[model samples]
Target: MGKLASECETERARTLTKEGISMDSEKVIKRDNEYVLHTYNRNPIALEKGHGLYAEGPEGQKYLDFTSGIGVNSLGYCDLTWAEAVSEQAHKLQHTSNLYYTAPCGKLAKKLCKRTGMNKVFFGNSGAEANEGAIKAARKYSFDHYGKGRDVVITLVNSFHGRTIATLTATGQEVFHNYFGPFNEGFVYTTAGDIEGLRELVDRHTCAIMLELIQGEGGVMALDPEYVQAVRALCDEKDLVLIVDEVQTGVGRTGTFLCCEHYNLKPDIVTLAKGLGGGLPIGAVLLNEKTAEGMGPGSHGSTFGGNPVVCAGANVVVDRMDQSFLANVSERAVQLRAGLAKLPMVKNLSGIGLMVGIEFFGGIQAADVLAACREKGLLVLTAKSRLRLLPPLTLTAHDVEKALGILNEVLTEMEQKAPKEQA
Candidate 1:
């Protein structure tokens, strides 16, 4: 009976693979279109397997990955240490209700607090959830101490917060605000790095000012250091909570454990996700002493917030992001930017550390550059008018050279195809 059952499972797996009904990108897209809501404009390629900075598509074509699953795979795909830790923890204990304390979760929280100097940590399932927790904590802190009528949160224009109702409202982009009407109130928007604009908008009713240190989706724009410092001072004087949304820029993406370290500013609240779980889903909100006590028991909860398996993976990820590892990230960023700048199609480069954006000149659209790069066996991302690159932190010098070579070839082809100027 056991042999028969094992044979049955093997046959099922074989059948799925043979029929391409498994995780094939095309098949998955077809199934998703038939049964799932279409929200993303997905690329044509279907990813199947990965190792370090390389991924294989369903067709078995190898591509050098510069997306890193949109900045979620910090250590690259299928990292041995991370996989082993997750597998071991999964066998021992996958999950338990938040009512019961899990050692892995506690250990992860302690590591985060100790490394970041934050007073407390609240776990969740994604970047959006972490930001949501931060928002709730900020509002509750204001309500408990300063009384009612001060619940407004000031987010910068072009900032991408999340898709949840409250976070959607908190998001500053006008495009996301649509189709979700009668939205949550008390969320306001301000221009990025505009000190006067921020001062004008932040009133007694404003309880918190949330921002991304480097707006990832907003064209990879970095906030001015002086402006950040000014906002920190204002938050302190006005008793307002300063929340840093480090969803994409955190976890050594910007050559630091937290992007705030680059500015040397300590925010009232810091939210993390993306690379925290090493490709597994996890998010956290770190709070200082003043706001840490604001969230009491029964105030907030999540069922799978800090699952043991996810925390175990996160522990491994955190352990790998040492000082030497982060310095290499900076060094790679320099190499990537210098290579991109040499391309004739490249107009300007933006962003810091590994999160980079290449702007094309001669009226070439970002979409064009992305499509060209994709066709050349190089996976890349785009933000507005710039070609974005978020390669794995573990990407070697050889992989970088190969990607750059492909990019150069594509850009040259594009230039050759262009029409000459009219005399």
Candidate 2:
């Protein structure tokens, strides 16, 4: 039952065994509940260690990691090179406030700019901060040029930007709007793939348009390619800033170094986080020449942003995402999608590259599927009405096959039990 639910989470705290064993998982979860904020409904297992695409519980039970820490561990769990880079940087000089320059920051900035054709970079601590910086830059650019009338940014309905008040406001979903009062204003929403509705939203007051090439948390939905091209054209015609929130889809998660690469879009600004730091905390806003200078000194800053250790890990990640690596990601995506399409309960698949969504048509809940998978030594994620898979980029061939096999077994079990469940 540990697989089906938080089977082991409710037990009292544990102590050392007769042979002098260390503290087990239950104690940690118990302590966490007592001290930590109740924001997350965390899973039961106390994952103590990880390597490659596998994580081990407190009792040393290994599980295949398909969620990849929600698309943040691009190199999977504790890759050797990434760990070495981070460790070396930490020893060298871990923290130097952004007031002064550092080698790692400049190196990462150049790599990102050269790879993505973005001219400038702003560092932040998370996706929300990155998006906030972008929003500010867009509005500032508008104010600097046109002045006083244009400040609105149009994002797609159901699209997710971040968790901050400004980003929550920028997000087009109404559900996230509750309880967060008086969110930073100047954001509007429109239906995905609807050009006419977009036109109606864009008046003289519009400053920019934000897009998530593949809307990750909003049920893994992707915008139509033709529609994206149309949006790019419209932005060009109107001189509107185009911002792509690639927090989940960037850093080679979508089979390309950046999701915009798949669309051949050189957006005015692109925000990145998640996989960029492998497993460390980091975020960046990549800006093009047209908008690079949009933000000047004294405008924005973060204390721990661009930490040397994080940038070191990020540099390693970026270096490994060359042409050959991204090509392999595309190939793996094809393999996984093909396998998923043949599953008994999967009605369809949405998203691209390693970022995928399995839409079930047999009335099976995505949350149930996720729990069942976890119980069966496989970890997965859920987004809205679908099961989202954000496997690590460095996932091996054996792990992929193992994940698909477990998924098939789960689908079969669900289908077999569906009739009884209804009865």
Candidate 3:
């Protein structure tokens, strides 16, 4: 016997809560807490729907989003073109094995290579996988040319690569080194801008140097341009591969196709993920002529690397990152930084384009500011001890003004509520 629609609704409600309470934000949170692993310190609100630069909680509390899902939503929430492309591709050709060819994947690759001047591309599902593939490529390049003993990759301190064992091992922070035992070796760490230290670390065993132009996880600091140039020159001098991990700073997030463009630098390999697919999961390793043949057939691959729908969305995103669009992004970044600079408690600001980090005075807490801003219809993120803002590249002066207003209000409230010694 078939149940009535009303009965089905009642059953769902009962499943949500033993007391037959209807699903709400609190109920959803409780259910997730009970079922899901406690990996993230989740926000209180349960996201329900979003459009443009705004989102709503289960209870319909609107929020002006600055996080952009940590810089993945390049075109903002459910951009019409991006969504349509993804949907059209999903309906037409959802997926196929890497053994077969797909138009969307090929098209996206062409666009990436054309824009970045890279010779080849290898797709992956996330930043970690892309970096993992890059590590493999760097080592293989050295082994193919030199030998096995030259496998060490020098990475900068405070640089974040990814979560995989190899990438995590490559990450220079000691905090991420816990729990994961016996990490892959051959990775060396040096301080950012420390050319002398970097020189000391490199040897016949060193195969590559990997770094993030702007350390997003490490307080959003931009590496000095001169230092980055020095690193590039060193790579050229030492015949070591240079791999720029642009997972967070790529795809127009930093007002450029790649952050390396800011320094007029090029690398043997570059890894991208966060903003490349707009809202979908996609990562790519761009290989230059020096290391184009690093990975041959069957050397490395991913089943879902070049998914049709994800690549479809990424194509639109790439098309939108044209010079004019990126120029607008740079303009908005200036406006955003100018607005933040006017705020009373913002002690210092760092980052380029839309990627911004805010350091505060009077002992302000990033977590407290995040909560207060959420309560006031704004959403932000924290990096280390400071606040991080990765607003959509489509952000306008008007949106920046509204976001700044909310942050100013939150900082004012916190300052007023702070203890005398802290203030």
Which candidate should be chosen as best, given lDDT against the real structure?
3
After superposition on all CA atoms, what RMSD does each candidate show versus the true structure? 3.3, 5.7, 4.3
RMSD of 3: 4.3
Cα lDDT tens digits, model 1, 1-423, are 334445866898799889877566778668767887778888877777788988998668888889999999999988888887887888789988898989999999999999999999999999999999999999999999989999999999999989999888988898888888999999999998799999999888999999898988889999999999999999988999999999999999998899999999899999999899989999999999999897999988889999999999999999998999998988888888888889867778888899998877766778988898888889999987788999989887788889899998988887777765410
Worst 10 residues of 1 by lDDT: 414-423
Please give the ranking of all candidate structures by lDDT, highest first, separated by commas: 3, 2, 1
TM-score of structure candidate 3: 0.94
The lowest-lDDT stretch of 10 consecutive residues in candidate 3 is 1-10
- TM-score (C-alpha, index-matched) for candidate 1: 0.94
Which run of 10 residues does model 2 get worst, by summed lDDT?
1-10
The list of candidate 2 runs beyond 4 A from truth reads 1-21, 420-423
lDDT of each: 0.89, 0.89, 0.91
Candidate 3 global lDDT: 0.91
> Model 2 residue 249 lDDT?
95
